[model samples]
Every structure is written in structure tokens, then in C-alpha cells.
Target: MTLNASLLKQGAACGQEGVPPPPLLLSLLDSSHHILCVSHVSPDGDAVGSLLALGSILRAQGKRPTLALQDEVTSEFQFMPGAEKIIGPAEVAHSYDLIVCLDTSSIDRIGTVYIPEIHNQIPLVVIDHHVTNTLFGTDNWVDTGCAATCQMLVRLADALGVPLSEEIAFSLLTGLVTDTLCFRTANTDTNVLQAALRLVNAGASLEFVVRNTLDSRSLGLVRLWGVGLANVQMEEGIIWATLNAESRQRSGVEPHQSDGLANFLVTVREADISATFAQRFANNGQELIECSFRAKPGFNVSQVAYSFGGGGHPPAAGCTVSGSLQEVSARVVAALRELRRQSVDGDSG
Candidate 1:
């Protein structure tokens, strides 16, 4: 069924209340034919979930949509419906009526999937929840208040008059569950719970999502965590760990598998801030460090990340820097120390 403009307006008023639908987005979708959809590199739950759910929504609306990602979906997220259908940058065509960039803060976050030579002429639409979004799209729909981009898609689905199918509900719920760490994040407000409730009511299983995502971990990942913990260091209320290439190879865990280390470190009673520095290689074959940071409530980490040319929320953020393991870890740790000091001083002031 085509979107009923009056019904959409009423639904936005009564269902979403203060969060009205973007009329321009609606108009764009209505006019578009074939579309290209993409998310960030190193696809996370929110990235994969939002891309697949949006693809399903567009297909339900009878529009041909192509889903693309710069990185392969990790094994953990492969269970998500439509995960197998996602194409890589090599397969993306040079033409599309429109491009939908989801859950990414900047154009570079989309990685190689976005080729300026081929896609510069196409109108870009960015849908994201990051406070650090660069607004590098012809139309940007960024809602930092939303816990996840999938939540925004829930509202978009309502505006498009597309009923939430089982697949769409599952995809959306996966993003909500993982990004919020099963609703444990500080940002898990009433709106987040309400959005999750609607997805559950539509046929997504909370238990299933938790079991597959937050609860599931590989033996190698457990070993990797152990390695990280073994090298843990703390000073001045900031705790951190390093995962070098040798440690990672010995542990036999994929790079993405170590994501939760920083989150785990922040749980220490003595730490108000936490960081994890993992050695990685960039596209140019140069050594770089991927730094992930987490802050306890009332402490902001995004500013530090932004200073280092990265971006995220107040509670969590990250950046990539060029350097050896020791060099990067020392530099980032010093930065985190200053950030913690500033936070304490602000509280005192």
C-alpha cells in the first residue's frame, strides 16, 4: 500500500508525538526510483541493522534498493536478515537515483563504498544518531537524542506507511539491543524503551537478540580479553589496556571481537574513564592504532575523540591515530588523564 499522507501525519502526531517525520525525506523517497544504501566501515550492529532494515522498508515500498558496505558483516551479525545480500564496494554501481548513508558520522566513515568519482552527482541522504555527525549529505537527518539510527528508521517506517515486517522488526531491534547494550547504556531513556517496545510488539524477540548479540562471545574473544586484562594499567581514575598485533594473533580473535574491552574496563570501581588501544593496519599498509574510549556517567569522552579527529557520544568515543603500539597508547593515555582532570574540575566548579 502506498503511503497515505494524512495517515502518516496523524501517526507522527499520535505515535511519535514530538518527533515528527521529515517531510522532505518522505518526498524524496516518494520520488526516488533505484537507490543505493550504505553504512560505515567495520560494520557494527547499528550499522548493519539500520542498513538492512532500511533496505527492507524501501523494498516494501516497491523501490529497488541496493545495500552496500565497505567491510564484511562480522559473523556475529550474520544472523540478521538480509545480511547475506549486502554487497561490497567492488560491486556497487556508478549510478543510483539516490544514496542513503546510515549510522555514519562522516563521509569517510562509509569508506570505499562511497566513491566520489562515481557518486558525487547523486543526492546523498545521511541518517545517523551520532552527535558528531558532519552533515555531509544533500539531506541530513541526524537525531543525537535517539539512542540508535534504527530507532529513527522506526519513525521513518511509520512515515512511509510500511508495516513493520518480522525481518524489519528483528533488524531494528538488533540495532537497539546492541547499541544500548540491552538497554544498559545511560542514554536508555523513555523514548528508547518505547521504541524497543514497539519493535517487540511487532514480532522482534528481545531474548533472541540479546542471546545472539550481547550475550554471545567466542572462545578466542575470551582469550583476547584475558590478554587485554593482563596488560591493564590504571592511574588517576583512568584505566586502559593495549591489544597489540602479536597478542591478537596469539589469541586468534578477529579485530572487531575486542570491542567490549573498553566498556568492561570502565566498570572498575577505581576508574571513571577507560580506553583500549588496538594496533591495526590502514589501507596504505601503514601501522595505526584504533583507540576506543568509554566514560562513566557525567564524564564526556567525545570531546577528546574529536580533538584527535574522531567522534562519538559523551559516554563513548573513538579515533584512529598513526603510531606504534607504545607510542599511541602513551599519547592517548596522557590525553585521557587530562580529560579526567578537567571533568573533575568542572564538577568541583
Candidate 2:
């Protein structure tokens, strides 16, 4: 089914009523000469994929696009076309016609890579699928029910009549597969499948995307998982693990190695939620902890993440707590207990 002009108008009207805008968004493209595309720190596939795909889309429309990351890109994604073009916040300065932040729900989550000086000087556009999105853009497009930002971008392309090129389709498909865990997540719907079909017709190769993304794990990552798994602990049916900077360095593990390990702890028979606490020793002597959380269906990890200054989808979300790892872990456990109590109270009430 082709998206008609009236349907597009209705979508824009509905967006004014607070619905997230369609994925194939072109409103920002009008007269914007230079655009900055960004993703959050420790970016998963969806975050990076959305930025790259959208950057490509912007480039195709004759806009100069600079894909920026608040932090470093994972080794796994370094080979993606246009990935090498990502510039640091300091290097770019106040040079963009518009700054688009993707997949990140909040500004703090951008970490040290995106300095306040840079963000304060630019017009911001936020695009995301996280339920905890704060609408922190001069223009915001957030679809909590959407499986991934890439999925939203595909719809945006369709709405704006941008024919999906092979590269754009492949990049978007990578985001969909990575964010949905190859469609294992409950967010996949008929529309999502139809979007995938369109992308395939546009020349996306599922086999190539999966091979490059899922099957590209390194031996260091495998060993890092072994260490993390060994540290797994169970508390009241919740499985948790802590990976300190020392252990990570000794294992020669990079940040990417720890990406999906926390979700794997859900394999425990009694586990309802799984969490991982990763601490980085700072040279400046401030404590910072990265907390990754994942819950089984029916759990709202987004709420859990928000309580501690983070956000994402219900089943998958995370936050970084500014304290010692032990302190953050304790707070997370307490929050989970409170969440369970609230659940029980709601059920009984």
C-alpha cells in the first residue's frame, strides 16, 4: 500500500496531538543545509544503525550529514559504510543547521562525548523508540510502540517518498534485527513485518545483516562473557552480575564485549529480570556506574531505568548511576523490590 498525501497530512496532524511522527520524516529536510546525527553512549545496533541510515537519507536529499557519537563506536560496527565519518563533538563545533539525537532518551545519557557547549549552541531533533523519551528536541519524533528507531525511519522514508536504496535498507534492517533480537521481542507487529518486506524488496539482505551483526563476535567477547557469567548472582529470582574495570581490562575486553551479556542472565529458571553493573575507574576520581537492565515480558524495565536516571523500552533499558558500583547495585535491588511491591499492591487493589 502506498502512503498517500492525505494520509501523510493526517499523520502530521496526529503528531500534533502528541503521537510520535512517522519514521520517513522529511519536515527537517526543508532548507537544512548541514545536519548532525548522533546516538547514545555504548550504542547498541539500533542506535548506531538509525544514525547511519538517517545520515545516509539526509545525504541523499543533498544535505551535508555528520554522524556523531558521544562516545566511541564499537569495533563490530566500525566497518559499516559511513561509520568512519563520525566526528567528535569538539571537532564539529557549532556548525550544523540542525542536530538530530537518535535512540537516546536523555541528554545526560550522551555522556562526556557530547559536551554541553556543543549541544547548547544547536537546534536539536530527537528521534527514538524508548518509552522514557523526554521529547527533548525542538522537534521530537518518538514512537514507544515502535520496535526500533530504524523501523520508524523506514516509515519516514515511505511517508516522504524517498525510495529506499540498498545501503539505506540494509542499515535500517540491521537496526530492526538488533533491537528486536531478530523479531524475538514482542514489539514486532504486522506493520513491522511489512516494513521488513519493503526493505528486502529495496535490496536488504537478511543473511548479510545477521552475519555481520550477530555472528561477528570476537574471542575476547566470549572470554569476557565467561568472566561475567561466573560473577552472576541470584536474589529473589532476579539474576545480576557486576563487571569491574579491573576485570574488564585484565580480560582485554572492550565496552562492546559487554553489550548483550546482561540480557543473557535471564536464562535462569527463576529469573524475572536480569541486570549487569559495569564500573569504570576514573582518572579524575569521580565514580560512575553503568547499569544495564532487561526484564521478561510483562515487566516495565523503562520505569526501573527512569527511577535511576535512565530509560528505554519495557523489556530492555538501562541507566548510569553516578556513584560506586556497589551503591548503584544496592539502589537497583531496592528499586526492584519496590517495583514488585507496587505490582502486588496494584494486582490486589
Report lDDT per candidate. Answer: 0.86, 0.75
TM-score for each of the candidates: 0.93, 0.89
Error of 1 at 283 (Å): 5.1
Task: Please write out the lDDT profile of model 1 over residues 1-349, one tens digit for every residue.
Answer: 1233443333223223335556666777889989999998788899999999999999998999999998899889998878999999899999899899999888888989899877998878778888788767776677777888898999899888999998899999999998898999998999899999999999999999999998998787888899899989999999999998878877776666677998899999999999998887766989988889999998889888888888888898888888998998898889889988988999999
Candidate 1 regions with alpha-carbon error over 4 angstroms: 1-19
Candidate 2 per-residue lDDT, tens place, 1-349, comes to 1224433343334223225454333565665778877888787788888888988887777788888786667778776777787877576656677777888888777666556665566667667777787665666676666788898898767665678999899889989988887877887887678878888899999888888887778787777788788878877757888888777777777644575787688767788888888887567977777788887776777898898888888888887788887888888977876675676578789
In candidate 1, position 55 carries an lDDT of 93
Model 1 RMSD, rounded to 1 decimal: 4.9
